[model samples]
Target: MCDILVPLTANAQRIGTEEERKLLDQSIQLCQRLLIEVTLSEATKLVGRAEYEDALPGSIQALRFSLEIYGSGRSELIPCYILLAEANLGLSRFKQAEECLCNANWILIKTRDNDKKVKSILYRGFGRLYAAQGKREEALRQLANDVSPNAALTDTVC
Candidate 1:
């Protein structure tokens, strides 16, 4: 018999039924086992908003917890890095943010779905990091790569 332990978060604690609980438990088990692919995009917007509102520690914890459970291979995980990198950027941890952006870029490169969009996000993130580091040329290169703008892209700093 394979015994699996899936750590549940506060968000996973509010289901109102046994069946839902069972399903969530199973899903958590699969996540811990790395048998299910969890995408970072599913939760990033909420987390990012939380960060923007100065609720970053919790948001970062949620993302980091998810990353630990999901094993970080999915394309959706790219946004997790990006969001966390942004948080780090806020903290003036530029090197850490740069590393996170690099990882996001690698994930974007390997992703098959919405490559253009993913590349654009990665480019924008890199641009932000480069801008922070005073590398204007590098920042411009990345900004130029971001041609197809999404409605979500409001801040030009990124």
Candidate 2:
């Protein structure tokens, strides 16, 4: 959604669940045309709307498309894995989130691209996950590892 279309989500969501579902279904279908870029863009917009559960289907689709376009071992898959992890976290699916994060970690290790931004995101996500699970101390530890410059509010895992 563009800046001009930002109000569309908020306005339509107030109509009704069935109506929202119908519109979202159509949007998801449209996202399948280009597969990767458009789909991921929509998935990100869904996340921005705090529609994590709604984002999951598109996020999963984006992941498959990313793997198809960039292969499993490429750094490009990191964003897809992290996006799924974020959605899983939003849905309170801790195990699935952790699995997705672990896959991302494996990609980083395999590629030896343990880049700072990636580490920050991984740890930040770990922090969120641990907090969700009622492990404040562990969450703090994970957060401590998330010490990257301008990482706190500047960007996201995806």
Clash count list over all predictions:
1, 0
Model 2 misplacement above 4 A:
1-34, 148-158
Candidate 2 clash figure, as a count: 0
> Alpha carbon lDDT of residue 25, candidate 1?
70
Q: Compared with the true structure, what per-residue lDDT tens digits does model 1 show for residues 36-147? A: 2222342355445644435344345545655666567566566567776777776678897887777776665555445666666777777888898899997886787676
Question: Could you give candidate 2's per-residue lDDT for residues 71-157 as a string of tens digits?
Answer: 788888888888889989988999999899888977877897848878788988888999999989978877876874544443223
Q: What TM-score fits each model?
A: 0.59, 0.69
Model 1 lDDT at residue 69? 61
